[model samples]
Target: MSWIKTRLKSFGYAFNGLWTLFRTETHAQIHLLALVVVTVAGLITGLERWEWLAIILTIALVVAAEGMNTALEALSDALHPGHHPLVGKAKDVAAGAVLFCAIAALAVALIVFLPHWL
Candidate 1:
């Protein structure tokens, strides 16, 4: 119980970072909106058991990656506090990771949902 409490306390910073990301990040908002739509469509379309698992897993992975990326960018900016090419490139790379996850999620959706729609 004590260990768990200490672990949770350490997560306060992460939670704060996540809240900041949700409030300030436009792309994060967009991803969340898409997550809602995809979840609704999957449920309404009666996806197969495996499809449900894939859809849920993909959403989790993408969102988790986005959150981590947001944290990384924020930390980097705080540390650098000035315009540096390396910092800029690092941020861009983090953003690109989110984009890759979004694209992969789209592919997963097409694979799982296309037969029904087509």
Candidate 2:
């Protein structure tokens, strides 16, 4: 394949994975809901450009973390179909990474939105 075609094909694969994530993962669906809410709130509040940038970046971070966690969990489960303590621990660690990103996203939301509300 030509370089451009290969790049486009890769994008297609990435989008397919994202579709699977949203379709099969409840957590990803929740994140999508949160994204819609945050977007509406941002529009309603007339967030400044910098505030929008922060919100956008935070949302991306959280979503990326969740995606990574999902990938890790799926890989672990596939590799070790039987219950394993180490696999459980790896999955837990991946989940914790997602949690930390979520908390940071919350902090960013508060910093960017609290003043506007108050």
Candidate 3:
């Protein structure tokens, strides 16, 4: 019972984090909108199991990367509070990571959908 309670508490904390991200991050809202659009497209196109798996993985990867970028930006802002060269570099790197993930996800979506579209 204690172990189950601990796992549930962990899930609650994760949910709280996700809620905070969506509530506070404009980029998260955009990602969520993209997610909805992708999901609808996948359904309408009748994606195969493998295509669905790829799309799901890509979505998860992009979202996770964005979450990490957000966390890093927040921490960097708090620690520096002003424009410091190292902090700026770190923030840029974090943003770049999100961009890379977004681009990769876009590529995956195109590959998965092109056949259905054509």
Candidate 4:
């Protein structure tokens, strides 16, 4: 009972957070859309197992980063409650991480999709 309780305490918070985010975060919904598309594309394209793994992992990474960015922005807004340059910069930086991951995913997509289509 003690061990199970500890494990749940450690991980359960994340699930609750994800559920809340799914309900409220528009970006989370966008990620869900990208996730479905990327997964279907992988299956249709017949990527090798490793390529499929890479594509799936990359998409998860993108969504995970985006989710974290959304969380930070929410928390930041709560903490600041006013427009400040530093707060704005922090949000921008968090968003930039999402952008970087998205660009990387697009590159992976090009590698995966271009040869088949062209």
Highest lDDT: which candidate? 2
Best by TM-score: 2
Question: lDDT per prediction?
Answer: 0.89, 0.94, 0.93, 0.85
Backbone atom clashes (below 3 Å) for every candidate = 0, 0, 0, 0
Clashes of 2: 0
TM-score of each: 0.85, 0.96, 0.95, 0.88
lDDT of 1 by residue, 1-118 (tens): 9999999988997788778777898878887888899989988899989999999999988888898788888799899989999999989898898889999999999999999899
- Model 2, residue 13: distance off in Å is 0.4
Candidate 2's residue-wise lDDT over 7-111, tens digit each? Answer: 999999999998998999999999989999999999999999999999999999988998999999999988999999999999999999999998898899999
Q: Model 4 clash pairs?
A: none
Off by over 4 Å in 3: none
Per-residue C-alpha lDDT of model 3 across residues 1-118, encoded as one tens digit per residue: 9999999999999999899998999998899999999999999999999999999999999899989999998988888899999998988998899999999999999999998898
Ranking by TM-score: 2, 3, 4, 1
- Residue 68 error, candidate 4, Å: 1.8
Q: Arrange candidates by lDDT, descending.
A: 2, 3, 1, 4
TM-score of 2: 0.96
How far residue 2's Cα lies from its native spot in candidate 4, in Å, is 1.1
What lDDT, from 0 to 1, does candidate 1 have? Answer: 0.89
